[model samples]
Target: MGHHRAHVSQGHERGGGQTHEEHSGSHGHGGHDGHRGHDGHAEVFRRLFWVSLVLAVPVVALSPMFADLLGYTVPRFPGASWVPPVLGSVVYAYGGRPFLTGAVQEARARKPGMMLLVALAITVAFAASWATTLGLTATLDFWWELALLVVIMLLGHWLEMRALGAASGALDALAALLPDTAERLTDEGSEQVPLDALRADDVVLVRAGGRVPADGVVVDGSAHVDESMISGESRPLRRAAGDRVVGGTVATDSTLRVRVTAVGSDTALAGIQKLVADAQASGSRAQALADRAAAFLFWFALVAGVLTFGVWAALGDMPDAVERTVTVLVIACPHALGLAIPLVIAISTERAARAGVLVKSRLALERMRTVDTVLFDKTGTLTSGRLTLVGRAAVAGLDDDELLALAAAVEADSEHPVARAVVAAHAGDTPAATDFRSLPGRGVRAVVGGREVHVGGPALLAELGLEVPSELGEAVTHGQQNAASVLHVVRDGAVVGVLAVADAVRPESRAAVDALHAHGVRVAMVTGDAQHVAQAVAHELGIDEVFAEVLPADKDAKVVELRERGRRVAMAGDGVNDAPALTRADVGIAIGAGTDVAIESAGVVLASDDPRGVVSVIVLSKASYRKMWQNLVWAAGYNLIAVPLAAGVLAWAGFVLSPAVGAVMMSASTVVVALNAQLLRRVDLDPGTVTGRAADSPSR
Candidate 1:
């Protein structure tokens, strides 16, 4: 029930109310607004970096340096000790403004993040130094430290933004593949229009070697389209009239006239972008815990800083108490803690997206790291979902090739699925017959090579009282067990042979299934087919479990049952029937070839419709989680050590950590966490294997 509600909330039923903003080719900053925010933050940090660098010089110059260099005792101005504090104030306000604003926003929202931590620390150091400069006894100075902290933090943020830009090469590649302008057919020949303005049903002429402008159907010409972006097949696909082509795929040869079917957000390329965006915004329960911790740190730092100051003032060490209070405030904000999880998650999400695996939520991604069981739907998930001829038997005189030829000719005029199977099987080998006659739900008769031919199921053959051979009967029986349709070929009034075709698994299935097991995840098969057929598929794929003849609602129950057993379940499917189960599972993975369900239910969408994509998402999730943990540990470790030093725990050992020094340490720790998260871009997450049986080719 919780899962159902969550899916309902996240489902796009609110309507596409998408207001189009003129986005001039923005890269992956999650979305346009996010990109703007990032850019604004970067600009602020850049300004701060330079200003703080300038302040650091003055800060050093104001410190005993000029006095020593000139060998002259300079008269201290009224409250001359305040010079460092005033200069440090400039650095903190100018360089640290963004952090302060961000910290305040987080505070208002009751969630303190990196900004909150950094702002609190720097603000405290500035306030304390100002008081000390005004003749209020303060034990230590933090002028240099505060200036250095601002500089280091600004440098770190710039580098982090650059890393984000660099890791988004996939978006760049995708953008490069699409032509900015398309030639739309108009009354006066062709008009050049922005690609997005090409509406549905628009006729566009794509020249030879041009990329398809939108998801469209070939209207008047044929071409070989390189659909590597959508299908992941390195080879180009042969397209004829009435065939659908996705936008961004290159047309290798032949000029094609295509009628645009889906444009704007409706195109396949746009769908991929949406999936990538959705994946990046996903989150889990564990992430909530991390947010809670950062929020707690904010309050803790505020209260501890106040208490430290009160205690020292009561004990007559006013200056020392004020300094300790500043230390507490500076060390308390978990700037590193704020960045620990999000940075790694961001990098991992982008990394996975580029590989064509869109991660929907953090929970889904995290579960991928430790999933114990994976369930796959048979059609369109493990298998190609298309029926094709895989077996044929010849009569007493006819050979196997001749049987296929006769079957293909007799079924040439039929529109039934079985007839189409025969046609697809012998597509290029035989010329279709003339004078074809189709009998609805019964058979098709056509004149092939000046001879009459008839093709249909056993019933059609029985109508003519044809004798069935023992070999043919045995083959039909075996085929029934495997859920294959048997088509009989009849020529000159006699049954010549039989063709057996079934929906087969992809050729990549076997290895893909084994790879999942090797990763410690058990594979299961769930299908709406009969038990025997399901068993046949399971046995072929070496699946650990099978659930057959399942109703759509029952699939949801099965997922609940698996989750009840303390297993993290990942459901992979591309059918509407699988949507409920996909939504119910711990992780819902939809194949890209399955556009509707992929958008509706799954948290992870494999752009290439490869079962191997499941393995890729899991690998990336694990790598991302590991990086997050590593960064968190290091960030927390720095705080654990720095907090004690800042409080003068080692003062007796001649190791007093000054306010400036504490601020610098805190800033360094944040950069370390951010940089560590950036390493997730290098994680190798190949789906490695794609398991399938030989009966049919996988979906395009």
Candidate 2:
């Protein structure tokens, strides 16, 4: 039975498989537009706060409450009483406008939030103070309280908006990577043109230290390209003729002529920008839960305020009822609750980027914490994706070095991957070969040292009717079982030796797998390679599961199958073929060197093509989730205790919280939430060491 069939049941879509562009286009604008409006709103609040603070000084000095609290007599003046009302009205009109407008919008949407609660609190104080001034009520003057409340709310919102603005600036930073101009090559010479003017097939000249104008293949010259901004690979990659280069990547040294393949929105940089925008804009489950809680709190505070007014009015007077109601609303505005998750998300995302992990979805980051299995793609992920000589077996009459030298001399004229592997394996110099001739379905034949020799696979062996001698039979079987392609080297029509070639495994692969196991996450590998090839790689890395011979289209089915079997799977890959699988997993992690389509489908992107980045994602996800929970609990706990106190629950014991004191408590709770979210920055995300040991060696 197939290994996947034994472990996986049936496939079902669990709300995964959405591409980054689809998620971004659907949700990106709404969030950024909201943030832009918040930036404008922040500026308004900041200005209003400073002005209101100045206006409040005279209003508080002129009030009886201020004189009584500070043991000072109000200066006698003809119009001092009017000063308090005039300045208090200005503070309410200017400083409280944002809350009032936000509350109106929230009410229209039929979803009141912190804005509505704040609006209600300040409006109540305004009405009660004006009623006292007009001799319609016996309430103590609340003009000083009203001034302080408006200023404080404005300050809180201003600080919150600024923090969010700074976090969202990442999108702007990404877009700024593209240069404004390009050196377009024409028949006469090179001419600088606007970046937008460069079209597909346009040849562009890229100088040393200049950025690539568009995604293209290098047609001439060579250079070391710095793709750190796009892929998070700090080392510059060497690019020669026919090698592909991405737009926004810098050529560190040497000049090149590139044939543009893509420009404008089609470039990889544009795709990354869209992904970042989408992730920042998309709302996560935690954020949605917080929203629901805030909405519920709005209704809860409204009902509590109403009850406080009714109960106090029945027991005391209208003045006492209004005072208790205003305090209740002020204390239960949901400011902390509203800030809990978004602050954590903003800080974590910024930190993730610094560590070369790009979070494309808040929901993905949250889901990463619960991932039980991490499925890795084999080619370009576990292996180097390049052929290399793995082993050599020689007959009793010949040594291993002699066998390799003979094969290399014959295959040196060939350009096939297997030929290159043979030539690379022979460290010493090779004797000259002559009359080289290529076999159509077999391998190559040539004259080396005036002796006829042939090199090929099983097909050549069958063609020549050559049987492997007993001495080399066991080596051939072992090579075949381990998925290494065996090449037979024959001289004078006699089989003399065998050379095994395979895609070499990366040195980091073993360490990466061990690290995941240490973290209690099951490691699995999926590849389109044959069963033996996949099994061989899985065994070397100590992978728990292997899905071999999987077609690109069926990769997602395997992911869904794992999910159906109750596994929280994270698929990591680096190719266009891996796009569907990347989207189908609970969390998709794309290697930086992967195609743009795969990156677009993934929720998290590892800037470097390093599997250890998978470990970084887990570390960041768990740390971020912990901070979110801490802030949530603290915010919710603060409300549980402070709201009741503000509603006069301890009034019989001669203790009551004034509106100013309640405002202070509310602001303090917000500050605590902000500070707790900031603590996520302290998490160590470097993946060079795993479980306190160097990740370069897994055995240790």
Candidate 3:
């Protein structure tokens, strides 16, 4: 990552053999590492700044120019003149070692940039000061300027390194999600072994509260798995003998014997790591452009330095020529330019991680600000992906709660989604049912309080030749039009109530849509659901467009069509079917406890199911882009102004800029960039902050 020998990646492998070297290697170039690599760069710069600052004090105090400017004598003493040169040389070799070596490497690579410019300035100043100290020239001494320049440059770099260190959480934290050892069920009995010993078809025993060692299917036993880390679902899911379990999920309350279906690189967790590594491998366009800017500045300063010396020499003032040339080169260092994009990227990544957003692709983050349309998958993304009780109607004699209690008791032993939804919705104590029997497609029949109760759909009613009363039919007809699942509570051969189980649109979806509308971005829904069902959801959320009954294979074509119409599009989805479209869009976002295959294809992955996480992405992209441009403008503009002044272009106006003053301008420009980037951390991304219509909105 550093492009320096001190980068120090020991190649430690953990969690499916992903080595730290692979992680560090993806960090782009020497300048914009993007905060994914290395550990001690900030400490190195911090140490250099303090040591250089200390040595600079003696050099500055002993300089005749420094004492003259302050209207004080140089503490006249024997060998005092030797003090500035001696301390100044020590600062150049020790404090400027990093720049000196970096400049050499850049020269060998046939490229000139910030490091070369910095090294040239200090080296020239060092030579000129020594020449003057030895009586070659009386007025070219610049020991104080050289000392201050090195100290200030080191301080700027120290702050830049520290900012990057706080970026996205350490990759080691991802590795720690896996256990070092696993319990393998062998021919004799269960035995403890390292994770590497695991292979396909190997049976492993997972105890209560233990993480699954690898992705596998439950061969024996059952448990409610806490998969919030893997799927972003808050509730624990029950995994029986046939359910699949991902590696990194915890078995919360019981034991499970699993047959490993995947291990090492084949595991789902390993797939997530691969997606991140690939994203980092694809470098950023802005980073490359900044590097080129530094290259351009390098050549510009070199030509300026050469021309300044030639012009001043033609006037027969060689002492003035050397001083002006040194000033021109020193002021050309691109400290702010080198730090601009990297600092913004670092802060953006930090904020994204806190908001449960994983930026798999840097380009996606950069492009989100320009997206004009966001197309979302309807089933699991905009909706809750599970049936929820939304409506119920009862006969005149029966209360709604009474009808609900009867249906819940009859559906208690069933595993159907509709049955589960009904049972879960009951808040009161459920009276025990007797003689429970599954009626297959018709429904479930059981005896509760000596009454034969049946809970089912229209098929159950048809078999019994029953008709719903007008009161229940009103609710049933409305629910059917919206594609909700309707079931009847038939007790004592009489139809009493009808309950509606629909794919509940998440409460956050409405706010998510409203926020997008406020940003002037059109919200669109893509679903395989019927037209009426899709429009029902679209109208409720104030969506601008809808694409219903769209087959999964055709979803990519929709994204392509949007692009064809000259609008930037973003696709958000979470199914294997959504993978193609996620890859086809300009910015692909995988949201809402997404499937692994979808994450593999998406540029950004939201670990939480909150649809409002989409708003956070747009907010981050626009804010970070604004900072990058601001820093670049200030850095480039400062050089344009400072370079001319340093070259004595203002000499006719009696206002020639000195080297110490140029050094201050360079350091101040860099500090402004760093501090401006830090402001991004203050942005609130609570998922409610942007949606003003939401009750939980926070201050901007």
TM-score for all models, in order of appearance = 0.80, 0.80, 0.79
344 Cα displacement, candidate 1 (Å)? 1.6
lDDT of 3 by residue, 146-210 (tens): 88878877776666556555433333354477788999998999899999999899999999999
Task: Show model 2 residue runs off by greater than 4 Å.
Answer: 1-88, 129-168, 174-194, 197-213, 216-228, 232-246, 249-261, 353-356, 389-453, 467-483, 495-498, 593-601, 684-700
Which stretch of 10 consecutive residues in model 3 shows the poorest summed lDDT?
4-13
Q: Residue 461 error for model 1, in Å?
A: 5.2
lDDT of 3 at 280: 43
Candidate 2 residue pairs in backbone clash:
231-607
Q: Which stretches of model 3 miss by more than 4 angstroms? A: 1-37, 66-78, 168-282, 428-454, 458-467, 480-483, 490-494, 593-598, 690-700
Candidate that beats the other on lDDT, 1 or 2, i.e. the better one: 2
Instruction: Assess candidate 3 and give its lDDT.
Output: 0.76
RMSD of 2: 7.0
List model 2 lDDT by residue over 464-570, tens digit each: 99999998999988886666777889999999999888776777788788878988999988887777778877887899999987877889999998999999999
